[model samples]
Structure formats: C-alpha cells, structure tokens
Target: MTTTAGSRLRALLADGELITAPGVFDGLSAALVARTGFKAGYLTGAGVAVAGYGLPDIGLLTQTEMTERARVVVEALGDVPLIADADTGYGAPMNVVRTLRAYEKAGVAAIQLEDQAFPKKCGHLPDKELISADEFTVKLTAALDARTDPDLLVIARTDARAPLGIDEAIDRANHYAEVGADVIFVEAPENLDEIERIARSVQAPLLINMVQGGLTPDTAPDKLAALGYRIAIHPGALLAPYVLHGLDALGRLGGTMPDVTAGPQGLFELVGLREWSAVGERYRDNTKDGA
Candidate 1:
C-alpha cells in the first residue's frame, strides 16, 4: 500500500535537522507555503481562531470547525504534510479519540494535543492551568490507541512551563513520551537555557513553537537543529504579516488616505476580482459548441 501523509510525517520525524514549517491560516496560505518548497506546514490554533472565526483562541472553535478546516488545508497542500493543532483534544479522553480519528480521516500528517485544562486559552496568554499529569497520560494513550495507522504522528504539548514551571514541563513531556507520543512539544519555553533543557530531556523528537514577541525568542532554524530540536513551527510568522497588512489597509482606507496602486499582472490580478469571469471565458467555448 502507498504511504499516507500521516505515515510520511512520522518518517520525516526520524530524519536530519529540524523540520521548519511556517504556520498556514487558510487555503491560500497553505498553497503559498507548498509553493515555497517547505516540507511541512502547521495549522496554528491562534491563526485558525482568528482567521476562520474572527475570535480569540479561547476554546471557542469547535472540533468540527477545526477538522473541517484541516480537511480544506490538506486538500490545498496536495502532498505537503500538515501538522494540525488540536487544542486540549477538544475535551476529555474520548474527545481526544474522536479528534484523532477526524484528523486522520482528513489526511493530516500529525496532530498536536496540549495538556491545558478545559476551556484553554492561547499558550502565550495568562491564567493557564493543567490537568493532572496522569489524566493527560490517559488522553495521550487514548489518542495513540485511536490511530489506525502508526504513521499518524501524535505530538504531546505541555503548557506547564508558565503555570507550573520548567521542571514540571519537562517532567510532563517525559511522561507523555512514555505514553507513546511520537513527538514532545514544551510550549513557550522561557529562554535558551530552558530550550536546551527540553532538547536534552525529551526522548522523543522535540517540536518547538517560535512566536515573535511571544514567550520564546525567534531563533534561527540552524541553531535549533544544533540544540537537537527535531521540528520547529513558526506558527505566527506568516500571521503577523497578514495582521499588519490588514491593519495598514484599514488605516489607508480611513480618512485622508492615499490610493494604493495595484502591482503585477499575474495570479493576483486574475484571481483577485476576475476569477469568475476568467472561468466563464475558459468554458465559454464549450458552451458555444454545445449550443
């Protein structure tokens, strides 16, 4: 049988230097990322909540919504692997099982589940709490069991660094690895020292989130590879640009604004406004022949 996208991701985990994936928020973003020749892409919770629902990443998006988005992103990328964020597994152990199966059917390469308490907020946000480590282990095991294909990478993320401490986060990561997580993500590590500690501690491949202006500084991919990190997802890198562009466009559209001229006569020109007309023109001959 041909290897599925999930299996391919698992194989990539075992290979060389850290896999660098840019965060993709929509179909257009995913397509653009694939065109950039990156090996993988990440579906960030913050990006999804903000772009899909125009809401904060405060447990507002449902499982169906996220899974549907994953399906769309997977289709858009074609063969490019996708690592999706499944926040707190959307509920309990059973919920984790369902979430896993849904993403699997959607053809996601990997799915990351965090150990945050229910109604979780963004990792960089405050007032975070964690479930009992043992309970989370059960959920991780359930996620592992639910996967029909071993190639489906199950990434366990710990949000305990800020609330519990670095030691606790490392401990939790180790425990999750024991429970069969393919990769360990110690989210929001405070500094280089902590990142080094995580790189040394976790037995499974380590995945790090590098968000600009967030808890972790933006480190170069080569440096992360030198520290033994396996994969690094810059979930907010592309998003920051989109946010800034939108803000600037809104500002320009306000009072005393200068008109911005359109640039280039390529894909943007045709797809921006003339997409339907272009499609009609392409099929116009067929329709005329039928008539």
Candidate 2:
C-alpha cells in the first residue's frame, strides 16, 4: 500500500530535523511552496481569512470555508502534507468530530485545535481567553477519536500564555499531551526562555508557532531543534512578503513593474501550466485512440 501524506509526515517527525512548514493560504501559494521542495505546508487560518475573505482571524471563517480551502490546497500539493488549523474544532466536542472528519476527507495530514473559545482571536493577539483544561481536553480527546487514520496528527494548541502565564500554558500543554495529543503547541511564548521551557516541559513533540512580529521571539530552526521542538511553522512568513511586494508593484504601476519582463507565461508556469498542458494532451490522445 502507498504511504499516505499523514504517515509520511509522521515518519519525518520521527526522524531528525525540525519540520519548517511555511504557511500557504490558497492553491497557488501552496503550489509555490510545494515547488520549492518543502516537506510540509500549513494551511494558516488567519492567512485564509485575510487573503480569501478580507477579514481578520476572529473566528470569522466558517468550518466549511476553511475545509474547502484545505481541499483545494491539498489537491494542488500532491504528495506534500498539509497541516491545517481547525479553529476550536469549529465548536464543541460533537462539532469537533465533524470537523475532524471534514478536514481528514479534505486530505489534510493534520489538524491543529486550540483551547480558545469561539470568536477566538489570533494567538499572538492579546486578551485571548481560553476554555478550561478539562474542557479543552474533551475537545482533544474527541479529535483523536474522530480520526480514522491513526497517522493523522492531532495537535493540541494552548493560547494561555499571555492570558494566564507560561506556567499555565505549559501545564495545559502537558495536560493535552496526557490526553493523547500527537503534538503540543504552547502558543505565543514571550521569549526564548519561555520557548525553551515549554519544549522541556511538554512530553509530546513540540510545535512552535513562529508568527512574524507576533508575541513569540523568532528563534533559528536549529536552535529550536536543539531546544527539542520537532516542528516550527512560520504562518505569515510568505504572506508578509507577498503583500509587501504586491503593494510595491501596484505603487509603481505607472512606471516599470517588478518582474514584468517575466510576463504572464512565467506566472502560469509557476502553477505548472505546462505540466497540466501535457496532461491534457495525453488525455485527449488516449480518448481519441479509444474512440
């Protein structure tokens, strides 16, 4: 049997090297990331909300909306695994079951669930409230139970760092790990000390969220690996650059545009138009021969 993307991701995590999954919000962004030879890609919720709907990440994107986006990105990313963010499992325990089934069917390799209540703000954002450890545990348990594929990672995220404390966040991380979470994410650590502490305290493989200009201090991937984090996701790393360059190009439209000489073909080729064209010709030829 062919190894699934989830199994491949699990095996990669088991081996050495910290998985650096750059965030992608759409199919083309995912294609770009995949083309660069990234082992994994993350479907960032905040990126999806902002880029797709022109909204913020205040739980505004619905479960169906995010799942549909994941499906598209997954299709674009053939063999590459997509670690998706399932915000608060889209609701309570029962809701989490459906959420898990939906995302799994969408071909995501993993689904990250946070402890924040509905209308949850970005983890880097302040004043984020969290459901109790017990309440969050129920959701994590539901997530683990809901996955038919055992290799599908169920990541439990705690947004308690700023609201409660690092101690409370670490405690929740351990609690979620104890409840059978495949990975534990202590969101938005204040500094490197807090990051090291969470990595040391949590029993599960740690996932560090490296949001640019967010609460957590940026640490090198090797340093994070030394601290024992298995995965680091830079959710806004690409979006930030993409938006900045777009604005720069738009501002200079009256003048010479950046990369304008590359032309439309270069843009289409970025998403594999030539490869798709070959596939179309082959299909037509085969159909004609059969007819």
Give TM per candidate: 0.86, 0.86
lDDT of each: 0.84, 0.85
Model 1, 1-291: lDDT tens digits are 788998777677778768998998799999999998999999988788777776666677899999999999999888999999999999879989999999999999999999998778678766777898998999999999999978889999999999999999999999999888989999999888888888988887899999776778778888899998989998877877776576578788883433322321121222222443355457868899999
lDDT of 2 at 103: 96
Q: Write down the TM-score for model 2.
A: 0.86
Residues 61-119, model 2: lDDT tens digits: 79999999999999988899999999898888999999999999999999999999887
Clashing pairs in 1: none
Q: Taking the candidates one at a time, how many backbone clashes does each contain?
A: 0, 0
Cα-based lDDT at residue 283, candidate 1: 89
Give RMSD to native, each candidate: 13.5, 13.9
lDDT, model 2, position 45: 92
Q: Enumerate residue pairs that collide in model 2.
A: none
